[model samples]
Target: MRQPALITFAVLCLPFLLHSVAARAQPEPQSTGSDSDIAITDFSKPSSPGRTFAARTVINAPVQKLCGILLDYPEYPAFMPNTDNASVIQAADDFAIVNMTLKLPLGKIKKYRLRLEPRNTPQTCHLSWKQVPWEDLKADDTIADTSGYWHLVPHPANPARTVVDYFVYADPGYVPFGFRWIVDILSKESLPKTLESLRARAAELP
Candidate 1:
């Protein structure tokens, strides 16, 4: 079942729905440690009416290594919070189709498939994606489709260290998004936890 744009837009455009807030508030650093400094921001600002938001950090790993970690879908549940399991059902050098099951903050478990496309260049690599149809999921109808990106840009002076950005835009169809409490709780769990875990993983790798 296709989700209506109104609901998706409403959830995305929450802060700007009435345009009451003029400037988007930057999120404080979620955690700080010797491995890396991780920061998350609400890119879905009042300046722009969209669902996209980003998590950023600087790691002691090279861009290539970082990309490899991101593509290792099967390991997500180990580090990323709320993610129950993830597997790459199909993949090639340039693209991959992954199946994921996640437990939302409110204890709602949903499954979906994503088609990931990677773009590579000499110094930078980025992956962008959208939902895909997958028969094994048995979840397309109940859960809303979602999309986002992962960006890796290496430090010019320190090539071995890289700056990473993770963006996620989701719409939980028919879910009670209007409940600010649920939104607040899930917000604290999802992206922030993912970045924290990712930073730890990158630092631990040799």
Candidate 2:
């Protein structure tokens, strides 16, 4: 009787152990996609204090060329003015952890550490960041609630141009009801600049 009970217990525990091992063995994602198809779409709600912004552009280059340029972190400041510094702190087969410092016009510089995960293939990628409670700005005033995703879809009409889509959700910290205008203004101004800079960078690629 004890032997049978022990055998059943082992079977039940085997799956959980295997799952843990599989999670540990999984690799990080990579970014490798074409130009042209990268675009931003608007997904923000008016009533909420949160904001979302996206942009896309067509490039006169191949997907591999564009991916090479996109993955070059140290060169971000050269193309994007708002980005002061960006570097890959960790890298693996299917994912990369990147640290970025941005010079914002809102009187504060923002630093974010993003984890890039690949899905579907090297052609498609997703980047996500969780707000660190103590490290976040306006920690005492309000909580930092932000998440974003990047998708790379191939363009059937223009194979040379890849459609890159960006989606961001942000909750403005410590803003009064009437102060929601700040969120609107920031989203409108900053998102366009970011897209334009990205477009310019893609164009500059060899």
Which candidate wins on TM-score?
A: 1
Q: Superposing all C-alpha atoms, what RMSD in Å does each candidate have to the true structure? A: 12.8, 9.5
lDDT of 2 by residue, 112-205 (tens): 6666655445554444444434344445343346666545555668767665555566665666566555455445555556556776777775
- TM-score, model 1 to reference: 0.69
Please give, for residues 1-206, the per-residue lDDT of candidate 1 as tens digits: 35797788778889674565543343333444532566666645555323455677777788998888887879888777777888898999888888888776545677788899999787887888888776655433335556777888897679998877777766554545464443333343467677767778888887
Model 1 lDDT-worst window of ten: 22-31
Candidate 2 lDDT score at position 67:
60
lDDT (C-alpha) at residue 127 in model 2: 47
Worst 10 residues of 2 by lDDT: 27-36
**In model 1, which runs have C-alpha deviations exceeding 4 angstroms?**
1-36, 45-50, 135-142, 177-189
Clashes of 2: 21
**Alpha-carbon local distance difference test for all models:** 0.70, 0.60
